[model samples]
Target: MRVDDFDFELPPERIALRPASPRDAARMLVADTRGLRDRVVRELPEILRAGDCLVFNDTRVIPARLEGRRGDAAISATLHKREGPRRWRAFIRNARRLRDGDTIAFGGEVQAVAADRAADGSFALDFAGDEPVEILLERAGSMPLPPYIASRRPTDARDARDYQTMFAREAGAVAAPTAALHFTPELMAELDAAGIAHETLTLHVGAGTFLPVKAEDTDDHVMHAEWGRIDAATADRLNAVRRDGGRVIAVGTTSLRLIESAAGADDVIRPFEGDTDIFITPGYRFRGVDGLMTNFHLPRSTLFMLVSALMGLERMQAVYAHAIAGDYRFYSYGDASLLLPA
Candidate 1:
């Protein structure tokens, strides 16, 4: 399908700048082959059945945005994907000012020298000094907020806690697994009481997730690789649930992607630990997830395409239009949707 096939009119006001207070208070739009239903995120437990396995991506968002100076010019760097220790692929402001071999000092203590420019204008950076990059980033980096949030303010103390999910454990993701953000401890306990099981898989969200689809046709787009891991224990648990005829509900697109990437064509999931660049567009066959709970995505984005693959383009468009007409929040820190394919 064409990239334009996924396009929709999203009002600027609809883009959520702040998350809903209490998180679970965010609105939810449930879509299935039957029709659409508007509900609150807190109503998820009642919507799902017992014996269902909810798979979550436990990837933690790193404070990866950093401000530094290349000589006298101020540069803002957002660590996209990690390449090696002290090395990263980053999106920088004023790329023309910096070139290969130019050292950019981060917070006047640690420095990273530009190595090269990737085709997409992202920079390959290698840090200076003996200190590990992780250590330096921990000290100097700030939360990498999405660009739609026009507030140029620094990530405050509240963002440190609010931008992440309750189950975030593993590090490396630049973006949060947003669908998991609505889940609170109370909700988890409720699900547990209802006999619903939850398992975790990690997919360090790459900056590529936010990148727009530049291709004219969806099929021409190549997804960016992100490291992910699903341990044997979680695999065993998921398999057990599947064997018992339980539905596997993915909490977010990241978890769904990772599971589908690791699953065979026959729909059996396996233990996997590696990088994946799996792109799911409309017409792609799904192998793993039976249902999805996820945040509303941007227009013409790969994530929207993935959801379209789950349902259909026409149906997704209708749902999105309904969301817009109903004044539902959009994007990260926005509302969510629970999708069950027919």
Candidate 2:
């Protein structure tokens, strides 16, 4: 299939720029083999069965966006992936003006030397610091919001808290596992009362998640790798649920990808920790997850393709159209959806 096959018309106003005030008050569009149902995020516990297991990505989003000056030229940078304690792959704005050996100063507290350029136009920068790069980023970097949100100025304090998930624990992801954003403490209690068990995994979302597919043919598109891990305990719990004839509900695409990557041919999930470049599109057979809770995705994006893989392409198209017609918010900060396989 071609990348254009996933394309759709999305109105500019439908793109959500902010999260719902109460978080759980966001709308949810439920899609299954039968049809679509309009609902709210708070209705999750009532919608799911007692034996269903909810899997979530515990990876935390870091302040990865930075503003710096490269040899007197102002530039914007977003750290994509960490290579070492001080080395990282970063997308630098005005990268064309930067060259190897050029030094960039960030917030006047840290300086990084441009080492090399990757084929995708990303730069490898080596920070001049004995402290870990993560620490430096926490102090100098800002939240890396999606490009669709046009900031009138620079990132403010509100974005620092709003863009992050309430349940964030382990630190690594550059982007939040958006589906988890709808969850709240009260909603979690409701799930517990409803007998739905919960487990956590880790998938450090990378900057590549936001990259557009430039290939015409979907098969020719190369997916950018992201680090992920499924621990022994989580693996055992998921397998137990499957053996008990319970549903494995992945909280987001990140969790779904990690679990699917760890699934063996024997139909059991195994402990895994490594880089994954799994590109899920329509016609891909799901191996681990029985259901998915995810947010509305961008038109023609890989995330939309992944959701289409779970639900049929035609069904997803109809669901998206309904969402648009109903004036439901879209994207990371928008509403969510609960999808069951046909």
Candidate 3:
């Protein structure tokens, strides 16, 4: 499909500069076969079925944005994916000034050598110390906020707490799984009382998620690989839920993509741990996820394409229109959307 099919004009004011004070206080736009309905995040327990399971990405967002220098030129890097214990693939600004094997010195005594520049302009950064890369990131890096938000305003100390979700445990993701941002301990207790089950999986959301689909056609676009894991125990439970006629609603596109990657042609989910570059566009058959809860996405983004696949192109277009007209927030720190297809 033409990438232009996903285009929509969003007012600049729709972008959320900050998250709602109490995460659960954020607005939610629910779209289903029945119709579109206005709602709030805290009301999720009542909106979903008792037997439905909400799958969440537990991958914690790392302070992946780094500012460093090599000689006279200033360089900024966002570490996207870990290639090894001491190496990562990073998108570089002022990359033209960098060449293979040039050491860039970051704050807190952190340093890395640039090499293996990919055609996409991302470079392999091999760190120069025995200390864990996470330690280096902590000393010199800040939270890798979405470019949309970062461009509008500078990242501050608040984002360190706000960008992380209640479920964050396994750290690796460069980006937060924003849909789960609305969930809180109180909301979890309510969900438990309402008999709405929840589960966790790991999908280290990379900076690539923020990359725009520059390709004119969806067919020409390629998705960056993201590491994820679904152990046997969790897989068995999820399979049982489906076997017993319960819905598995993915809380974010990260969870949904990983679930689909682990599912077989029979629609049975299995244990999986590896990289998935699954590009979900319209016409892709969903195997594991019954519904999705996600933030409003950028126009012409891969995430929008994934949602269009879950629902329908025309349907999602209307859903987004309703959201915009209703003054709903947009992007990473934005209002939520619950999409349940017929």
Q: Which number leads on lDDT?
A: 3
Clash pairs, candidate 2, are none
List per-candidate RMSD values in Å: 1.4, 1.2, 0.6
Number of the top TM-score candidate: 3
Error of 2 at 320 (Å): 0.3
Give residue 47's error in model 3 in angstroms: 1.0
Tens-digit lDDT string for candidate 2 (7-125): 99989889888899799999999988668899999998999988899999998989888899976789888988888878888988899889889989998498899887988888989
- TM-score per prediction, in order, is 0.96, 0.97, 0.99
* lDDT for position 174 in model 3: 99
Clashes of each: 0, 0, 0
lDDT of 3 by residue, 62-130 (tens): 999999999999999999999998999999999999999999999999999999999999999999989
| lDDT of model 2, residue 65 | 89
lDDT digits (tens) for residues 167-202 of candidate 1: 999889999999999988988988898888999999
Better candidate by lDDT, 1 or 3: 3
TM-score of 3: 0.99
